[model samples]
Each structure stands twice: as C-alpha cells, then as structure tokens.
Target chain A: MRIGLIGTGNVATILGRKITAAGHEVVQVYGRSAIHAQQLAAELQAAYTTDMDHLDPHADLYIIAVADAAIASVAASLPLQDKLVVHTAGSVSKEVLKVASTRYGIFYPLQSLRKEMEQLPDIPLLIDANTPDDLALLRDLALSLSTQVGVASDEQRLKLHVAAVMVSNFTNHLYTLAERYCQAEGADFSLLHPLIVQVAERLQYMSPQDAQTGPAIRYDTPTIEKHMALLEQHGEMKELYAWFTKSIQKQAASGEL
Target chain B: MRIGLIGTGNVATILGRKITAAGHEVVQVYGRSAIHAQQLAAELQAAYTTDMDHLDPHADLYIIAVADAAIASVAASLPLQDKLVVHTAGSVSKEVLKVASTRYGIFYPLQSLRKEMEQLPDIPLLIDANTPDDLALLRDLALSLSTQVGVASDEQRLKLHVAAVMVSNFTNHLYTLAERYCQAEGADFSLLHPLIVQVAERLQYMSPQDAQTGPAIRYDTPTIEKHMALLEQHGEMKELYAWFTKSIQKQAASGEL
Candidate 1:
C-alpha cells in the first residue's frame, strides 16, 4: 500500500516510520516546514512536498496526521478527489476530512506518540469511515500497525477521547501537582512512584471503584482536613484537593465504590 | 529483630509475610478478633493474643498496623516501654505512639498493599524516628523488606501522603469515572488502557508537565465544550471535567507545563 503522510510532527514521524516498517510505502510527505518534511521523507524513503498539490494522488491512503487545529485547512487545501484521506485525531470528527476527498475516514491511534521515544507505544487503533470499503481499508492499515482495532462512531470516539483525557491528561496533571507539592515540602517525590505504579497495575485485575483507597475513599475526615490545611497556600491545588476529596467521598457514600 | 504485629489487616498480612521472609522473628500477633490474630500468627509461626496486655513486651519492635483512627488508641494501650514502637501510617504523626514507648518511630511503606498479591510491591519505606538509633533500626528493617528507604519528618510525610492521594487515590477515581462514562456510551473501556499505560510509562522518562497531552493541555475550548455537552447527564463527572479543564488551562497559561 502506498501512503502519503500529511504532516511532519511527532505523530506523522512515528506513524510514517511504523507504516513503512510494516511493508507499506510512504510515497510522499507533506508539511508546512521544508526541513521537517525533508527529514521525515528522507527517513521514510519518501518524496517530500510542502504544497498540498504536490501530494501523490495515486497513494492508497493520505494520512493527515497534523495538529487538530490544522486538520480542516489541510483537508480543505488538498486536491484529492475520491482517494482515501484520513485524519489521526481522537476529538475531531471524521467529517473534517470531507472537504479533501469523497472517501474520507478516521484512523485514530489512541496512544500518545513521542518522537524521542525509541519504541512506539501499543497503539490501540480506533477506525471510522463514511463508507464500508474505506472502513475496511482503515482497519486493515490499522491492524498492520497494531493488534487491537475497533470500529466506533463519531460520538463514541469523542466519549472515548474524553475518557482518555480523564485517565491520561488529567491524571498526569495530578502527578504534576503532586511532584510540585513534594518539591515544595522538601519530600522525595520518587517515594510516591511505586504507589503510582501499583494503582495503575491494579486496574488490570480490579475496577477502580474496588481499588480505591486512602483518606478520601475511606472518609477519614481528620486526615482530609489536615491535607486541606496543608494545601491552603496552594490555591489551585487546594481547590483540586477539595474537589477530589468531596467527589471521592460522594462516590463512596453513593455506594458505588 | 523480634517483631510484634498489632493488626491482621492487609498491611499486616503482607508486611508480616515479608518480615518473616526477611529472617526476622514475628514474635507475636495481636488483634481484636482472636480468630484473625490466630490465623495470622499460625501462618507466620508466631504466638497469638487478643488482649493488648498480653502482647510480647520483650520484642525489639512493636508494629501497629491498624486503621488510622485506631492508631492512637492502640498505641496508648500497648504495654511496651523502651522498646521501639512504630505505626504504619502515611498521614498520622509519630507523636501518636508517645504513650506506648519512648523510642517511637514510623515504618510507612508507601505502596498500597493487598493480601491477594503473591509478591510484595517495591515498597518505598519512609522512616521517621525520635532518635538516630531507632532510625537506623527502622531503616535496617525497611531495607530487609525493600531496598528503597528514606527519612521523612511528620510534616514531610503528611505532604507526601497528600501527594500519594493525588497520584494514586485521585487518579483511580478518574479511572473509575472514565470507566463509567465508557460503559454509558457503550464504548470499549479497554481501548483506553494502552493510552493509560503510555501516560504512566512516560513519567519514567519525563516529568508530568512534559508528559501531559489531550484537549485540556492544549486548552482546546471547542473540544472541551463538546465534551462538556456530552457529560451533561453525569453531574459529578461534568463538574470534574470542568474543574480539570480549567486547571489544565490555568497551568498552561501560567507557563508551568
């Protein structure tokens, strides 16, 4: 399968490499930056282009792996007619690619990709298409790069995207706050690493509600009070702490946990 | 070391097994329930007693691994004098053991322990003692069970305890919310697992600030609004989503991440 990568960012670099490694030909790379496009194109042994018009029209798939905000403009500028064009975004709808091609689809890989990372994460791909043939093609392409693949609607994708944010992005922000709090208090932040990993590992065997522990889940008011007092100096952290504590207690009281 | 365990809960069961495996003598086990104490004592090949007064007074260390609320009462009831007494608590103060023994300390294993786990987690021990001798002894005991050990003050422990909640307990709650949302939307919750693990694995190489992704970090208001609209039915989750989204945006605006 010949592929045309429509960006030179982390997603494009990593996914382009993976697509090429899986015996698919990344025939063309397009980007706003000449150097980045050339670098990615050179690495993937593909032709480089900054203009959307120069994109290989005969490519089996055109993957618009650009930033979310740039997807619409890129899709609009592309001159492809009926060729399969897909965007790799979790939040954005597949209809965003409709302006570029008739046979548009989504090839959302639900993993955080980093250019610095040596190995690509186990990307559980979520494929969606306007038509059945395009859906099957996206699924086949996704299966080539990942063992896990599923079909989902635009609404389902958005819900999963929100869920992904809750589990990954918001959770990481909590970690950031914790690290900051640890550093401010002169405590070793690494002390919490094992506990962090344990919580994540527990999800494999148990529901998060069943796995919940600590002062908030148990409603140990005294400890919660102490924590609240400690975070009084940190406005954002204090609000976050209180919100989570109340939320946890409310959930526990609701007999959900 | 001759150790007397004062509880038969999850911490007691796992830590007792580790202590015995580390070549220390679990001299006695004490619990409110005779059956629980006897069961744990039998498993560890130690003596059992339901009465606090019948505790082994000559033991080198008395470990009160009970509920946080019961710590002060149990410590006060202990019949030890000069023997080292420690409570396995994150937020509780070492001063709680003041009535039990003069050589009071803390042996806080920072990982969440479960009886079902076949092997002990990489227990990062945070020790605090009134004296250097007791500190060394606690450190040695901790070292026997795990290589990770460090000294922390009561204030420091409280801060870390708060951080632990942020990273572990709060994170798990978010996972719970995500799972619930997935179930409601009829999406595969397993699709988010790899993304979840990827976010965790990124922490090994980068700080959470650098590891953060998704609409929240990007301050993508359109997607945020879409998510908010989708979560209208989930009262708690809706508030949580708004809070985290605002917090992430604020953090980003502050140039923290």
Candidate 2:
C-alpha cells in the first residue's frame, strides 16, 4: 500500500517506520515544518511537502497523525483529490475531513508513542470511515499492520479516549504526585517500583475490587492516621493523604471497592 | 528456627504457614480470640492460646504479625524470657516490644498479605532490631522465608511505607475509579487492561520519570479540560482528576517530573 504520511512527529515517525518495515510504501511525508517533513521523507525514501497545495493524491492513503486540534485543520487544508484520508487520533471525528475528500476515516493506534524509543506494542488499531467503502479500505490497511484492529464509530472512539485518559494519562499524574511526596521526605522512590509492577501485574489475573488492599480497604484507622502524620511535613501530601483516605473509606462504605 | 506466631490474623496465618513450610516449628499461636487462635493453630499445626496471661514464648523467634494497636498490648502481655520478638508492621516503632523483652525488633514485609490467598509473594522484608544480634536474627529469619530482605531503620521503613501507599493502595483506588466509570458508561473495563500492563512493563526498563507520558506531561490543556469535564459527572473522579492533574503540572513545572 502506498502511504502519504503527514506530521513528522513521534506517532508519524514510529508508524511510518513500521509501515515501511511491513513492506508498505510511505510515498510522501508532510509536516507544518518543511525540515521535519524532509527528514522523515529522506529516511523513508519518500517525497516531502510543507504545503497542502503540493499534496499528491497519487498515494493510496493519506495518514494525518498530528495533534488532536491540529488534525482537523491539517485535514481541512489537505487537497485530498478524492483520496482515502485518515487521522490517527483517538478523540477527533471522521467528519472533520469530509470537506477535504470524498473518503475519510480515523486510524487510531492505541498506545503512547515516543520518537527516540522503539517500543512497537501490539496495540489495538481503531478504524472508522465516513462510508462503507472507505471503511473496507481502512480495515484492510489496519489488518496489515496489526491483528488487534477494529472498526469503531466516532462516539465509541470518544468513549475510548476518555477511558484511555483515565487509565493512562490521569494515572501517570497520580504517580507523579506520589513521586514528589517521596522525594520531599528524602525517600527512595524506587521502593515503589515493585508495588507499581504488582498492581499492574495482578490486575491481569484479578479484578481491581478483588486486588484492593490498604488502610481504607481493611478499615484500619490507626494505620491511616499514622500514614497521615507521616506526611505532616509536606502540605500537599497531608491534604491528598487525607482526601484519598476519606475517598477510599467512603467507597468502602458505599460498597464501591 | 522455632517460631512463636502472635495474633492469629490474616498475616499471622499466612506467615505461620510459610514458616512451617520452611521446616520451622510454630510452637505457639496467640490471639485474644479463642476461635481465631484455634483456627490458625489448626491450620499451621501449632498450639493455640486464648488467654494472654497463659502465653509462653518458647520458640527461638516471636513474630508479632498483628494489627498496629494490638502490637503494644500483645507485646506487653508476652513473657519473652530474652527471646527475639519482632512485629510485622510498617509504621509501628520497634520500641513497643521493649516492654515484653529487651530482645525485640521489626520484621516488616513490604507487601499485601491476604489470608485466603495461596501464592504468597517473595516480599521484600525490612528487618530492624534494637541491637546488632537481634538484627542478625531477624534478617536471617526473613532470609529463610525469602531472599529479598533489607535491614532498615524505623525511618527507612516509614519512607518505604509512604511509597507503598502511593504505588499499591492509592494506585489501586485509581483503578477502582476507572472501572466504576467504565461500568457506568456500559463499557467493558477490560479495555483498560492492556494499557495497565503496558504502563507497568515500561517501568521495568525506565524509571517513573523517564517513563512518564500523556496529556499532563505534554501539557495538553484542551485534553485536560475535556477529561476533567467528563470526570465532573462523578464527584469523586472529578476531584481526584483535578487534584492529580494540577499536581502533575506543578511537579513538571518545578522540575520534579
């Protein structure tokens, strides 16, 4: 399959490499910045473009893997010439590209991407097209790249995006907070590594409800108080510690845990 | 080593089984409740005592694996006769057992222990005693059960305990939130399983700082707002999402992440 890859960002670069490795042609690379586009094109032995006016519909597919907000703008500007176009976004709708082309869809790869790192996870590829014909083409393309590919509507994708943020993005922030408190107390944050691994690993074999363990889960008020007092020096920890303990206890009482 | 397992609670029963498995004798199982003491003793094939006054610490090592409050009272009731007595608690100070005998310490296992579970983790044990001899004794006993052992002071164990809450208990609560929201949306919570596993796997090769990803670290405000608004429907998630996100951004700004 001939592919026109847009946005020489982390996702584009990683996916482009994978596509090229999988014996598919990355015919061109497009970016807001010409230099970034050219670098990726040179690596993939493809053409480069900075202007949407220069877009060639000669390629079988145009993949817009830019930021969520920027995706619609880029898709809107592209001179699609009736080519099948798709954006690798979890949140954006397929309608964003309706004006730019006769055939449009979303081709989202569900995993965090890093430019320098080469972690090609066997992630789920969610594909959605404006029309049935476009969906078939996108499904074929998705299947070539991954076994865990499925066709989902915009609403389903949006729901998934919400779930992804809750589990991945939001969870990482919680981790960052814990790290801060640990550092402030002159504690070795590495001590938490096993626990992190344990939580993640156990969830595979057990439900979160069954795997739950803590002061609040066990209803150990004395231990909870000791933990709060331990965080007395750090103001933020003190507040968060109190709040989370209450939340857990509340959840426990409500049969949420 | 001969063992005197005190407080026939969840942790005590689990530890007693492990001790007996390692060919150590659990000569005495003490608890305030007779049924509890007898059940544990029957399980471990050890003797049971309901009366604290009738307690005889005949084993080489006395393991105080009970609740935080009972640690002191149980220790005060014990007639150690110069035997090594250690409590398996994170926040509890080793000084409590001084009332029982001069030869006492803390044998804190840094993992969640459920009585009904069969597969026990090779937990990292934190050993601390008043004297070098007691420390050696405690470390050796910990080593006999599992090789992952550390000799830490009260301060060190406390530090690890804080990290434990962050990674295990607190993180698990976040899992509960994710599961609840997913269920509310009539979505399968299993969708987040792969994401959870990926996050944990990444930590094995990269430190938490380097492994950090998502909207908060990228400072994607629009995505953050959308997530918060979605979480707004659930009071707990909204508050937690706000607190965790704001905390992450602040930490990133302060060069913590």
TM-score of every model? 0.96, 0.88
Look at candidate 1 and give me any clashing residue pairs: none
Predictions' DockQ, in order: 0.78, 0.50
**Could you tell me which 10 consecutive residues in candidate 1 chain B have the lowest summed lDDT?**
B248-257
In the range A80-149, model 2's lDDT, one tens digit per residue, is 7688889988766789888779988899877766666647766678899888988888888788887777
- Tell me the tens digit of each residue's lDDT in model 1 across A109-202: 8877878776778889889999998888888889999999999888888888888888988898899888887877788887788788778876
In the range B167-199, model 1's lDDT, one tens digit per residue, is: 988898899888987888898888888887777
* Candidate 2 segments whose C-alpha is farther than 4 A from its true place: A17-25, A33-56, A116-118, A140-150, B7-10, B13-58, B115-119, B144-148
Span of ten consecutive residues with least summed lDDT in model 2 chain A: A186-195
- What's the C-alpha lDDT at position B77 in model 2? 74
Score residue A228 of candidate 2 by CA lDDT.
81
* Winning candidate number (TM-score): 1
